[model samples]
Target: MQAIVVEQITKSYGAKGAVKALDGISLSVAKGELFGIIGPDGAGKTSLLRILATLILPDAGEAYLQNLHVVRDYKRLRSLLGYMPGRFSLYQDLSVQENLSFFAAVFGTRIEDNYDLIKDIYVQLEPFKNRRAGALSGGMKQKLALCCALIHKPEVLLLDEPGTGVDPVSRKEFWDMLQRLKSWGITILVSTPNMDEAELCDRVALLHNGRILAMDTPAGIRGSYERPLFAVRSDEMYRLIQDLRQWPGAYSCYAFGEYAHLALQQSLQGFDTQADSVMAELQQYLESRHHTGIEVLRAEPGVEDCFIASTKDR
Candidate 1:
C-alpha cells in the first residue's frame, strides 16, 4: 500500500501575489520504501513534510497517509506517525533518557515496550543516557532525536534534513541507520539539500522553488541528461566559467567543485555530437584568451548536474 500521498498541494505564505512555498506539489511514497524529497533550503521541503505529517494544512489539494485524509484524520494520523523536524526540537534541558522516556510516554508506550525498534540506535546513546541533550554533539543529538521519534514504532517516519549541521561521520551513520529501518517495514520519507544523499534514496522527487522539477529514481533522472558534458578547468577558475558560457559552442556551463561542467551546443543539423571536436574547439578558444594550464575532459554527469540542467530554465 502507498504509505503517503500528496496531490497538487500548493501552499504559500503572505499575500496572494507572494511567492509560493510549495507550488502544486504531488508525490507518493511506497510502504517500507525510503523516499527522499531532494532540494535546497526554501525549496518547500519542510512545508510539504509538515502537510504530510498533518501538522499543517495545505492551501489547496489533498494529502493522505495510510489511507487517512491528512486534514480530516489528523488526530489519529499523528499517533501513527514519527516526525523529526529539520531543527533539533527536543528539550535541551532534558537528559537523553528523560527525553526518550517522555516521548514514549506521550505516545502511550514505554521504552521497553518498543525496545526492539530502537535497540541499534539506543545502544549508541546508552553510554550518554545521563547527558543533557544540549550537551551532546551534533550527531549524538540527532541520533537521540531519531530514537525518540521511533520509540512509538510509527508506521511512517518523516525525517526533515536529519543530517543537517552534523559531522560527516554522523551523517553517514544516520543514513546507515535509515537503511536498517527500511527492513523493519516502516515507510520513510526524508528531505535533504545534499545531492549525494539523493542517490541513497530508493526514489527522489527533485524540488526547486516549491515546484517538482523531476520525479524519478536517481539513475533515471541522471540518465535524462542527454548531451556531451565536459569538465573544463583553467588557471583562473572563476573566469573559466564565464568564458566557457560565452564560447560559441557551449550550450551550458556551470561551476562544479574546482572545475566547470559544461555542455557544448550541437550542430544545427547533425545528430551525432562529436565530444572531442568540441573539446578541441574549447581548448583553442581558451588558448587564444591566454588561459594557461587548461584541462578539458569529458565528465560523467551526476545528480547535481542533472538538477541544474532541469531547473535552469524554470
Candidate 2:
C-alpha cells in the first residue's frame, strides 16, 4: 500500500465557501519515497498536508495514510505519522531538552528509547539543551521541532515549508538530514515554495492556484517544456523584456536571472523562428529597436522555467 493517498480532496473557506484552498487534488506517495508538493503561497500545500496529518478534514474526498483513513482512523494514524508544520509550534517556555522529553512522553515513548533515531540531530541541540526553546536561533528551533516530531519513530513524516526563513546553510543541512532519514525507510512528504528544492525529491507535483499543474520526476517535467527557449541579454534588461514580449515571433517571454528567457513562436507569417535561422534576424530586430550589446542563445529549461510556462495561463 502507498504510504499516503489523497483522492479528489477539496477544501474552501469563508462565509459562502468562497476561497478555495484545494480543488480536486489527488496523488499518492509510495513507502520510502520522498515526494514534494511544489508551489508558491496559497497553493493548497498546507491544506493538503494538514489533511493528511489529520489536523483538518477536507470539505470533500477521502485521504488515507498507511491504509488507514485519515478521518476515520485519525487516532491510530496520528501515532504512525510525524508532522512538522510551517511555523515553530514548540513550547517557548520549555528548555530544549524539556520540549523533546514532553513530546516523547505525549507519544508514550521515552527520549532514551528513541535516542538512536535522533542522536545525530540531538547532538547539535545538546549544547543548548538548557536554553529556552524561544531563545534558540531559527535553525536550532527547526532542529528541535524535528527531533520532537521523530521522537516516536513515525512511519511517515510530513514537513510543511521547513526551509522558510532558514539560512541557506541550515536549509542544505536539513535536506541532508532528510536524505539520511530516507535511508532508514521512512516516507517523507515535504511542501515548499522554493523551486530549486523540487529537483531534490524523487518526484514532484506542481501546485498552483489551488490546483496541480503537473506531476512528474524533475527531468520529466523539464522535458515536457516542448517550446524552444532562448536566454536573451542586452544592456537594457527591463526594456528587453518589454520588447521581447511584444515581438511578433515570441511565444512566451519572462525574466530569468540576468536574462529574459524568450520562448519562440514556431510559426509566424514572415519570421523563421527556428533556433538556427532566428538568431540573426532576432538580433537585427533588437538592433533596429536600439538595443545595444544584445546576446541571444538557446537555453535549456530548468524546473522553474517549466513551472512558469505551465502556469502562465492560470
Candidate 3:
C-alpha cells in the first residue's frame, strides 16, 4: 500500500511568479519504506514535504496520505503524520520533557501512554529532561525533536534535512536510529542535501532545479553512469584545469576532491586509446611548460559525480 501519493503537485509565490517552489512533482512512497529526496537547497524538497504533511496547500494537483485526500481530510491526516521541519521549531522556553509532553497533549495523549513509542530515543534525553530546549547541543536538540515527532506514534514520518546542522558522528547515529524506526513499520520520507546519506534510503529521488532528475536505488543510479572517467592532479592545479579544458581530447573536466575528474573525447584517429597514452600526452604538454608532480589514473565515479553529471546534462 502507498503511504503517501503526490500527483502533479505545483506551488508558486509572488504576483510575477517570481518563484516556483515545486513544479508538477509526482511521487509516491510505499508503506514501511525509508524513502529519500536527495538534493541541495532550493530543490523544492521543503515545498513538497509541506504539501504532503497537509501544512500547506499546493497550487495545483492532488495529494493523499493512506488513500485519504490531504486537502479534504487534513484533520484526519494530521493525527497520522509526524513532521520534523528543516529548522528546529520547538519552544525554547520548554524543558525537554515538557516539550515532548506538550506535543503529546496536542495529539490528545500523555507521555506514559505512548512512552514505549519513544522510549529508546527519550532515554537519551532523560538526563536533560529538565533542561531548556534551546540549551541543548545541535545533536541533542535533533534527538529531542525526533522524540516529540514520534510521541504520538504517527504512521508516516516526514523529516526535512534532519542532519543538516549536526556533527558527522551524530548524522550517522541519527540514520541508524531511523533504520530501527523503519523496522517498526512506519513509513518514512526524509530529505537531505548529503550525497552519502542518499545511499541509506531504500529508494531515492534526485531533485534538481525543482525537477526530478532520477529516482532509484543508489546502486541503480550508480550503474547508469556511462563514459570513462579519470582523476588528474598536478602541482599547477589551476593552470592544469584551464589547459585541460582547452585540450582537444578532453570532453569535460571539473574539480573533484584533491584532483580533477575528466571525461575524454573519443579519439578520431581510429586508434584504441588508453589511459597511458592520454597521461603521456598530458604529461608532455605540462612538462614542456616547466610543470611537475602530474598524476593521472582511472577512477570510479561516486554518487556526487553522477549527480553533477546528470544535472549538467539538464
Candidate 4:
C-alpha cells in the first residue's frame, strides 16, 4: 500500500500570508521504503513533514497517511504515525525511562509490549535510563527521542532533521537504526539539509524555495546534470574563484570542500563544452595567470552539483 500521499499542498504564514512555506508540493512513499526530502534550512522540509504527521493543515490541497485523509482523520492517523521533530522536544525533567514510559502510556501500550521495536536503541540508553533527558548528550537525547517515537509501533515514521546537531558517528548510528526499522516494514520519510545524506535514501526529492527542484534516486539526480564538470584547485583558493568567474566559458564555480567544482559553459560559438576540451581550456587559463599546483580533473556530479544546476534558473 502507499504509505503516504500529498497532493498540491500549499502553506503560508504571517499577516497577509507574507511567507509561503510550501508551494504546490506533491509526492508519495511506498510501504517499507526509506524516502528522503533533501534541502537546506527554510526550504519547507519541516512544514511538509508536519503536515504529513497531522500536526498542521495546509492552506490549500490535501494529504493522506496510509490512505486516511490527514485533516479528516487526524486523531486515528496520529496513532499510526511516529514523528520526531527537528528539536529535542521531550520534557526536560523527565528521565529517559520516564519519557519512554509516558509516550507508550499515551498510546495505550507499554515498554514491554514494544520492547522488540526499540530494544536496540533503548539498550544504549538503558545505562542512562535514570538521567534526566536534558542532562544527556545531544546524541543520547536524540536516541531517546527516537525510542519514544517508536514505542507505539507506528507503521510510518516522520523524522525531521534528526541529525542536524549530532556528531558524525552518531549520525551514522542513527541512520543504521533507521535501516533496521525499514526491515521491520516501517515506512520512513526523513528530511535534512545535508546534501550527502541524499545517498542514504532509496529515493530523494530535492527541495528548494518551498518547492521540489528534482525527484529521483541519488544517481538519477546526479546524472541529470547536462554539462561537463571538473574539480579545479590551485595554490590559492580565493583567487581561483575570482579568476574562474571571469573566464567567460565558466558556467558555475563554487567552493566545495577542499576543491571547487566548475561547470564549464555549454556548446556555444567559440566554446567547446566537451569534457576534455573544457579541461584543456581551464588548464591554459590558470597556467597563464601563474596558478601553481593546479589540479583540474573531470568530476562526477553528485547531489550538491545537481542541486546548484537545478536551482540555477529557479
Off by over 4 Å in 1: 267-273
lDDT by residue for model 1 over 1-314, one digit each (tens)? 89998999999888773979998888888999999999988999999999998888899999998999999999999999999999999999999999999999999999999899899999999999999999999999999999999999999999999989999999999999999999899999999999989999999999999999999999998888776788988999888888888988778998888899987566333424555676677799999988999998878788898888878756
**Model 3 residue pairs with clashes:** none
How far residue 52's Cα lies from its native spot in candidate 1, in Å, is: 0.9
What does candidate 2 score on TM? Answer: 0.94
lDDT of 3 by residue, 1-314 (tens): 99989898889878866799888888899999999999999998998899889989999999998898989999999999999999999998999988998999999989998787787878888999999999999999999999989989899999999999999988888999899899889999999999889889999999987788888888888777776677989998888888888877877889987999887666324333566787788778767767689887877777777788788877
Candidate 3: worst-modelled 10 consecutive residues by lDDT: 266-275
- In the range 1-314, model 4's lDDT, one tens digit per residue, is 88988999999989987999999999988999999999989999999999998988899988998998999999999899999999999998999989999999998999999899999998999999999999999999899999999999999999999998999999999999999999899999999999999999999999998999999999899878787778989999999988988898888899999998888677333434355676777799999989999999778889999999888856
Q: What is candidate 1's CA lDDT for residue 294?
A: 98
Each prediction's Cα lDDT score? 0.90, 0.91, 0.87, 0.91
Number of colliding residue pairs in each model: 0, 0, 0, 0
Residue 138 of model 3: what lDDT?
Answer: 97
Tell me the lDDT of candidate 1: 0.90
- Residue 275 accuracy (lDDT) in model 4: 56
> Candidate 2 clashing pairs?
none
lDDT, residue 15, candidate 2: 84
* Candidate 4 global TM-score: 0.96
